[model samples]
Target: MRHVLTALCLVLLTSAPPASAQDFPSIGSQYVDFGASMAAVGQMNNVMGAAVRNRRSDRVDSPRAAATTRYRPSPTVSARVRTQFADFIARADPAHSEGLRKFVQQNDLLGAWEQHVAGDGLRRGDVADAMTAYWVQNWQIANKVAFASRAQVQSVRAQVAGALAGSPGFARLGDAARQELAETFMLNFIAQGSAFSDAAARRDAGATRRLSDAAAARFRKDMNLDLRALRLTEAGLIG
Candidate 1:
């Protein structure tokens, strides 16, 4: 399963960009590439020694030590992930897509159609029209697929946790170490799954917000670490 996920990530990262201009224009192309790269990096970290290191470091005794040990994605990667999220939502929901188009048109978000044409040979109106069409075409399919994919990920996590608990190797570990190991594995699992699941959640604004809130809550429940603090440490963002 891990190898499958690793291969999936690799494919996503190296796959050619969508050839159809109608599917993804200049800015959208940038976003998909960035998001895929971020996902690949996450997959690599989870597959390599990072997960092991996190497990070993989970034995910290002091609050400060725990605080310093939380994993954080790079700031630039986080920004790109967020942008991809917005783009995904815009493409998957008709109402959201229309709202975005209206907002862009009202605010002149891309400057002018002529300016976009001059810069990238893409007209602002075309981008808006494309988003609308994409949303209409994908709304139902995207939502259904996203829901199923998220459920499958959760099921896999449960299976992994159960297997680990019953393993002889896990039984040999000291109580503290066993707990740490389980937590580390679960955290890594969530982190890896987030790369794909969160992208799926972007099919709906409510789902996206819920995913964010759930992540913050999970960090607190699983690690006794504040998600906001971790974000601050990673991105230097206040509040």
Candidate 2:
């Protein structure tokens, strides 16, 4: 439970050298052109068709405010979508933490999923080593979707995490079969977690829950497959 998202962020910030903020917004080039164009117009109309005195030509855009993204994501994004909820996971006992560590290495789970699946040191599959990459990519997509709104992501993920944290030692069977099944369940949860929060995204969310009932039937099949895979493959106790 390493909080990989925060770790990733700190890595990004610390990896690159810091730059001064003022170096940007290199003076308003757009507004200056507009104001200059208006001045060139000889006609200054008034209520009586008379030339009216004008204020300072410096009625330009704010010098301080700079351009932001066209579609800015929320600043609390990390809390929402980042898989690195490792801090909460790490809060367990040392024995549990050690178990979680084995789980992390076996599944190759990023620090975030480590937080999501607070296991008791279960390792990933001994077989199917290559396909493990699929789980990682799947995890990335799930995190990206959750990043849409952290509160929502946290809401659902918190439920599952609380389940695992509250009821530990669920992974009694430490075998390749269980490892594979656990991976399937974990990735499916990440996907469904985002779908739960994204009303629009639920249309294709595989699991048709309350928030995303648009194509519940279609996603229902997917959810079934995912759960079935987990239960059959990993021995999950999901009813």
Candidate 3:
């Protein structure tokens, strides 16, 4: 009964009615391809290790240490991650690149759209959620393209290629495996999107709990996005 009522009060940007107080984790940190997010992930894992062992790195200075010691990972980690994620992306996807270029253009329009619909904040948020997913697709496709031109991605690709070049474990896959992985990601994304659309349709929280399953499904799909590896390469527009 409480669940039904809470669902009605939900902001509806990919959240279900709160089944419990457990926050239906919004795709916030996971969705956006912030640059330092990955490094932050590493840093926090390091910090956590430091705390457990009571050891600190030269890099883990000041408040992060204090905050980590105090058991406040969210605020410290979130700030650090956001900064790092942005920086990494700038390097990964350079200026005028198609994926980076497209994302910048879209984020500008999105920001403008949000301002106009500022009063309808919840509705704007929902649209933002959808847009973020779209950006993820943009990043994946562009990153794959960008990777082709990248020494690092190429190195990884070559290693994978060499590893399986003569191996009996799916050895015949060769480069076809890369194409297959791409296709699989696209297919999975389509299925995930369809589920989210259905979830969003019956978004209201009734006793039936309609679309909760879809929401959970969509959440899982976005969660698997390798967020730490995500790169947001916005050019002049979204500095």
Q: Identify the leading candidate in terms of TM-score.
A: 1
Candidate closest to the true structure, highest lDDT:
1
TM-score of each candidate structure, all chains considered together: 0.23, 0.22, 0.22
User: Whose TM-score is higher: candidate 1's or candidate 3's?
Assistant: 1
Error of 3 at 211 (Å): 8.8
Model 2's lDDT to the true fold?
Answer: 0.25
Error of 2 at 130 (Å): 21
> Tens digit of lDDT per residue, candidate 1, span 87-116?
543564444454433332232212221231
Candidates, ranked, lDDT: 1, 3, 2
Which residue window of length 10 is worst by lDDT in model 1?
A: 230-239
- Per residue, candidate 3 scores C-alpha lDDT tens digits across 52-144 of 233212222122111100111233433342343334334444442333323322232223222322332211222112222333333333222
- Candidate 3 lDDT trough over 10 residues, lowest sum: 64-73
How far does residue 230 in candidate 1 sit from its true spot (Å)? 2.4
lDDT of 2 at 146: 24
Question: Mind sharing the TM-score for model 2?
Answer: 0.22
List runs of model 3 lying over 4 Å from the truth: 1-173, 204-239
